[model samples]
Target chain A: MSHSRLGRRTLMLAGAASLLTAKSGLTVPARAQGLQPTTSMRGGANNYRPGAPIVDRIGGGGFLMHGTVRRAGDGAPLEGVRIQIWAHTTEGRERDARSHGATLTNADGVFELEMPQIVPAFGQPHGHLAYDSGAFETVFLRPVMDSARDASLAAHFVLQPA
Target chain B: MTLKHLRAVIAWGGLATLIMIPIAVAANSEYLQYRGPIYIAAGFAGIVALAVLLVQPLLAAGLLPRLPIQLGRVVHRWSGLVLLLAIAAHVVGLWITSPPDMIDALTFRAPTLFSVFGVVGMWALLAAALLAAIRKKRWLRPQVWRFSHVFAASAIVAASVSHAMLIEGTMGALSKAALCAAVLCALIWTVWQVKPWRGVRRRQNSRR
Candidate 1:
């Protein structure tokens, strides 16, 4: 075969191979690329809880993220606020296999969460934390690696009354 | 054993191994333990469904050297039924595990890209199976039936392969990718061999 013909064949093969393997890589659309705060807040059957302790369920690095929730208007500490956290682990995405339960804020509106270490294959290192209090507008916090590494992250969330 | 018998044995053995490897890899995945039995079973079913896709093109094209064409057709028919069952189990298992997610997937409202491909593949597979079931009635013209069958089959192969490749699940990535690539290649090669497109073009030209 001529060099030009061989080059064309190589290009065709390359295109086909990319099409076949495209799904295995990062292919999420630009619109849905970021953290969907509102949609991500809805806890699942296993994860939703009004007042569940979460310290035991978290695994991986000793990284901890604690925060206080308060009302946006009056700035009063909001108790009984449901909080859920999920992230990629060394294995893969947090499926039903992983324990990603939701918990409620204590009387002081305090909450602490242990972050899971990131798996490079799982893409970006980030954690999704959602706050739902039924009486207030739900809030979701997308904490990156920087925030997760902080010993006392002091992450505070403000929610508006619904 | 005679040479012909030995060849048959070897072919069958190779086919069995090719089919079982994906299931074995999926069963051994550590994530299966975490996801529980239903999830594990669902993943296994999906793997089996993809593996079944590999057998289909070979059977349809009569490429299985050991089996007679008549026997191959019988096996192909039964394999189609098995594929349907596996898909049903996979979908039902997933629905039980997460109803909302399943609903989102079915309705095309799911945020995950893989869900869209998977749902499309599922529907295409169903349409193909339904067409196959009613094909003997001759309700549709031969050309129409053949066109619809090939279209549905292509959709199923493309969408399912994309769906499987996109999802990061219990199935080992290397094995999953290999199986998907093989299925896509087989379907493409079979379609080329069959040349259904040429028949469709000829029919169109005759109408003109």
Candidate 2:
């Protein structure tokens, strides 16, 4: 067999082996269990809006993504550049936990802000750690379902070199 | 790759896909599909990787001597490789699926203990793999490399178990907790069985 074909065959066999080895009884145990719905969302209603720029200080053991956005070529901090942030929960359920926003770079093109939590308003508990203070903080960023701009570009602030 | 190597690779790859597929399919079926599958896959992959780390050293030192040493070595090395792949899949798949969560987990902004543990476990596993890959370099003494390997692997297992325990979703609270306990027990067993520290103690005592 060709190397690629051999590789595919090997992957298949490994899958079979793992299936055979897995605790055979978990299928029923897995399916019988149901999703624990969160009531905290207040009737599928979301209060958070998308596309508002925010800069959170996140000093008290909280969610802070502190960084400086600089020009890619010159390595100079891109002052006053805007940075936006937004995120959704794992379940695709948009709620208050994924609040989105944007903030301008400070004099150094450096911005410090607490990232909002992405946990559902009524779902599995989420955590935010303050990278600034080294303590875990519990807070929720409102969830986002749809937005006009790229979330990555929203979160990252980069300066174009002159 | 040799026939044997090919077989091993196939088996590992197939198994990972099989385990992951149903969950992905199930997610599409349900309203909260993506959430359930991603969390479960991440948790399961971490647990399995922990199991590999917990089980291997004992098999290498204890069972290997009793059985065929070469066979034991093969299992250890291959499974270790599989564990690395599983972790890679867990992170890469998740990254592709959700860039925000990946950033959150990597940056330690995940909401639950599970995410924290998962991230930390990933780092530990990475460190251990790095040591293993570079063990033969002149700068790294064999003894130092061995100690670092054991320490990093142990950290990975512990963090993974913590992660498994902390997640809540389709796996059900009880089953998820049980998996975590089982993983912890396996970790403890491996540590006790290998007793890598015992050798250090013996050497020190002998000198005394």
Candidate 3:
């Protein structure tokens, strides 16, 4: 065989051998599971509070996450509720030093958050929000779908009093 | 049939079969079952990337017997383009599915080691493609381009292999490891046979 032909044949044999080896079911020991979070949930944790400046910085394609924080028993809007909103951006984490902060509900117990463009990361196109009030149970909202295109997401927090 | 023709048929058949493994494995993986369309797309993209990696070195080294060296060069260029597209699809799919992790990976803040390796590999692959694209227009010396190409290729192979090995995801473990090993061996073998370093040394000696 010519040198070129020989090289080709060697390549073919290597490919065949690799395929056969793959099919042979030579298993490696399985690693311990459950250490890593699902790709969507990774880096989902955020404790940064949103300030007025941060909310002002939300630009086009941004949406309002506005809803009443109500008491679970009688469904009355609860006042002075602290709400934190964070979502993925094209740059970095929403709650990173560059874009970190939170807001509070008004006397009517209505809170609104201006979210940046929803760029999905980890698992799906989603965002994170949390509700906290001194007299009520704290609620962490995770992997909230970015439904901005349709309508503003009304994430009502029905908290049980602590 | 002539012996040579028979040999060609077997070789092509074997190569085709080898190419199908990653695609088949991706389609059948349990992790992809409940992951929705975007995730499934990413899985398929990753499989295509791996498959491209397998063929690239062979084409570059002109190891495909039936193809003339000129044809091999054409195929290699097209393969490089396909590889870039596959990688772009993979990253976009993953980004749509999960922004935080993708952000972490891109920003080099990802906690997982595999994410770091994957990001580095991706950048290296992109840089290699860019370098190849601009080589003629930039009037880069052949020796400089060759060295840069080899360095970028080495980074890509090393980082991608490590990234794939550490992640236990959609790919079948046995097939994934086998394919990775094959790719690494082919890259090392091709680089060794080409002896790119010799050109660099010769150029330096002439410059002295």
Candidate 4:
């Protein structure tokens, strides 16, 4: 066999060995393992949390995020939680689900979307929610339960930079 | 083996390449028409690559006899190359199309985990290929190469599956759910075939 070919193989083997050794006991980051995170809700520039936008059903007049947020150590309903709702849409092949603008919470810590319908270039119909003013732009908004145990469904929104 | 099997592998690899090239070109262009289809195409490639990676170990252990060993190896290598090329094309094309994503891939935070998975797969593959080329080198024993190759292959498969699961935009609708199922099944099959723990059990039983 050609020395050059052998050398190429040797280099490859060395690299593989090193990678295997390095990764032996180390835990690969979730991202490295294929967990893609979406944009997060931003509480100003300081406290940022990854926000995974979920669908929530609106009750009566005001909008509500309807999901529970808790402290790290204890699982308690983080009362007075403020969630910012941003909304927008694209036409189909263009624009994308970019955040158009944001809406804040009221006394009940609920946010109602102002624009129900948006017309972007080739956009699909979707909504996003940000929690705790953290950086997480999307969240898994759990549906509020009714007496019938059915999911109350409604539109959600996102806030974009101007 | 039969000539038909060889033909099939080549054809599949060729078809995958054909599907991949346009997506690359489209991704790289600024034209409005190129965006949606390429996004869809990249998603398909990811699913296919994950499937192939998941099946490779089973095929290696002689679990899939319907596939010829040589053909299996060829399919694995070629499919891997196609996946890598598609990713590179997607990245380069997207750079032309979406510079932010290109930056995200480099920075290791591309919103979607696909970029992270792709990057690791790429590096692992490159190393595996290099070592396989030099298997006869006296200093690098065959056993060492074998162990490392197994680990790298596992990483590639695991990363690819994770990337696919995390992605929201690609493979939307029922197709996405189906792809997820396929990945999970293949992963299960691969782990079973490898049976990395089997050796430990055998040793323990003997000691007992």
Candidate 5:
């Protein structure tokens, strides 16, 4: 191909790319942009508060559930909040109170709980959690880990006041 | 087995390995727990669709040893149909899992950027299919059809690769990246071999 032909094609490609990028930018909503904090995800909040009493660990400890508790909008970390967690583990199913536990967030809003490795039941390995402190609007999160072999899963809460 | 059969086996086996490895890598994903059967089926359909991309270019270029070009073309056509069904299942299954999310993705209101590229790819694939289906109508001349098909194919690859790369979901990062890279290479090689651009310019010159 001639140099001018190649150069023109390159210029045309560059022009098309810029146009597409500009068009994509226009698709974002005006007021709110990106993945905003929602009330709850679909399939979330199922079987919340099934009479599981507070415990430190759910069976033999091998995996962890950890995240920060932050207030909505301004993202202020809230301390001393109780987060309830459950999963179908080698020890028990999510329905079993023995598979449930709760932990309080530290002063930095960080919370971590040791739990047995979640065993996949219905679909894949996952842990369910709820912010049960009543200070914030109840948010039930069912977080799935990236890998079954991973020892940790994170479910952060950005809460709205009740 | 004869050398001919061995080459055929090697060729087909290599392609199948490329297709199957990514699915195996993604099987370890924990997100599969919450997904329903339909959703899982849908996920597989999409994964397979991506994998089958390797075959299309090979078939189009007549690069697959022991496969006749005529047979390869027929397989290419059927695979295109399968791709359409897989994509439909993927969308419908996701819709069943979460209607609002699927609707957002379909309508371009989805909050995540991945949905945008995915939606773009879906439409491009659909357009390419439509173009292929009407290739007999002669609405577009052969050169025009070839150019448009190549354009649409490129769009589909670009969009799907972007969509796959953005989502931090089931796929293993390295395997997914490798698959995406291999797809790009196959497509580039096929297009280079076919030299569809040269045909278009030559046809225009002949017409003048």
Candidate 6:
């Protein structure tokens, strides 16, 4: 096959392959078109507390959920933003009022809240958080713990200005 | 090119296809970066094994173009051994990565739906591999061996595909599904053509 001919053939084959897969279905990219750079992940919004209060730290045996909150447009850090957090912990399930709490982002857009050590609920160790306040569009997160033994999980959020 | 060379090229292409799927995942997947090296290897081993399976049934039924059925059988046996080893590496690597999780997986205590299917596939593969090792045993009739191996093959493919599908991992969903579908198609086609259920009748026909 000549260089141009071979290239055309390859392109056609690639197109066919993509069309076949696209018709079959796309799992990750199908929902990606509608999402912000940092948005609520699937299952992230589950078990969110609509108005959980900001506290110094939740009942703590020491697992901290912390991350930076950035603005979606310019990536600027947003301060005083409330990030509500909860998890299935030794103390209680994620739905339990004691297991849920909120923390405010500081000047640098970093927020951290100490809570009871998260245990695997339904065989998955995960924590849920939501940016429930009016400052930004609501974003919820369910970050799986690296391991049940790990003492912390970091969940960063980029908020779109409402 | 001569027909013989063309056949050889096609045969090698099958192997290349098997290797490329895992390479694509390892090189491009965002999830793999977060994983430890051992865990990554385990994940790749599973991917590689699944890819290899695409060519397996083709070889067994002598459908791969240009290769003789006898040589294909030989390659099939060797590939079977590779499949066994790859699966072993995958399980062992995972165990080293997390003993508690592996235990949960093995004991069916894992909450994740994938673990049960994985366990089933792994055990089925073990059973299939064992059948080959005991091929010469007097108690093991050839007919029985063939039936059991065929049964095990389908179980392995079904469970392994389910396990792979359930995982949200390094493998691209489209490519992963394509590879899996190819493997299933190859297996079903081979089983249908081979028709192990006709064992005695087919053998008797050949005797004449």
Q: Which ranges of candidate 4 are over 4 A from the true structure?
A: A1-88, A92-162, B1-35, B110-118, B133-139, B170-208
Which residue runs of candidate 3 sit more than 4 Å off their true CA positions? A1-162, B1-11, B202-208
- lDDT of candidates 1 onward, in order: 0.69, 0.51, 0.69, 0.46, 0.77, 0.79
> lDDT (0-100) at residue B184 of candidate 5?
82
In candidate 1, stretches whose alpha carbon ends up further than 4 angstroms from where it belongs are A1-47, A53-82, A86-111, A115-128, A140-161, B1-17, B201-208
Q: Give the DockQ of candidate 1.
A: 0.07
How do the residues B19-90 of candidate 6 rate in per-residue lDDT, one tens digit apiece? 586568656865554456887788888887897678777887888877789999899999999999999998
Clash number for model 4?
42
Please provide, for model 4 over A1-162, each residue's C-alpha lDDT reduced to its tens digit, 9 standing for 90 to 100.
535655877899999987887789464555543323323421111112244242342212132223334333233223444554432222222123233234444453344443333221111222344444544333433221232112222423232211
Interface RMSD computed for candidate 3 is what? Answer: 9.7
Fraction of native Cα contacts reproduced by each candidate = 0.00, 0.14, 0.11, 0.03, 0.00, 0.00
> Relative to the true interface, what fraction of contacts does candidate 5 keep?
0.00
CAPRI category for model 3:
incorrect
Every candidate's DockQ is: 0.07, 0.07, 0.06, 0.04, 0.07, 0.03
Q: Report the lDDT tens digits of candidate 6 across residue range A86-147.
A: 87676765556887888899999999899888765433677888887886788877788776
Q: Which tens-of-lDDT digit does each residue in B97-190 have in candidate 4?
A: 3454456666776434466776776677667666656766745545566666666766766666666555443344344445445545655676
Q: What global local distance difference test value does model 2 have?
A: 0.51
State the displacement of the C-alpha of residue A97, model 4, in Å, after optimal TM-score superposition: 13
iRMS values for every prediction: 6.6, 8.4, 9.7, 8.7, 7.9, 11.0
lDDT, residue B201, model 2: 28
Total residue pair clashes for candidate 5: 3
Q: Which residue pairs overlap in candidate 1's backbone? A: A97-B34
Judging by lDDT, tell me the better candidate of 4 and 6.
6
- Cand. 6: chain B TM-score: 0.87
lDDT of 2 by residue, B18-118 (tens): 34543444344332443545654654564456446545664555432234667776777778788999898778766654556567678876544567888
Candidate 2 — which residues are off by over 4 angstroms? A1-162, B1-54, B64-67, B138-142, B198-208
Expressed as tens digits, the lDDT of each residue in A1-162 for candidate 3 is 535656877899999888887688453437532222112234445433534233444444356667767776566776777777766543344545443446678888898766554543343345666654457656656555533243356666777767
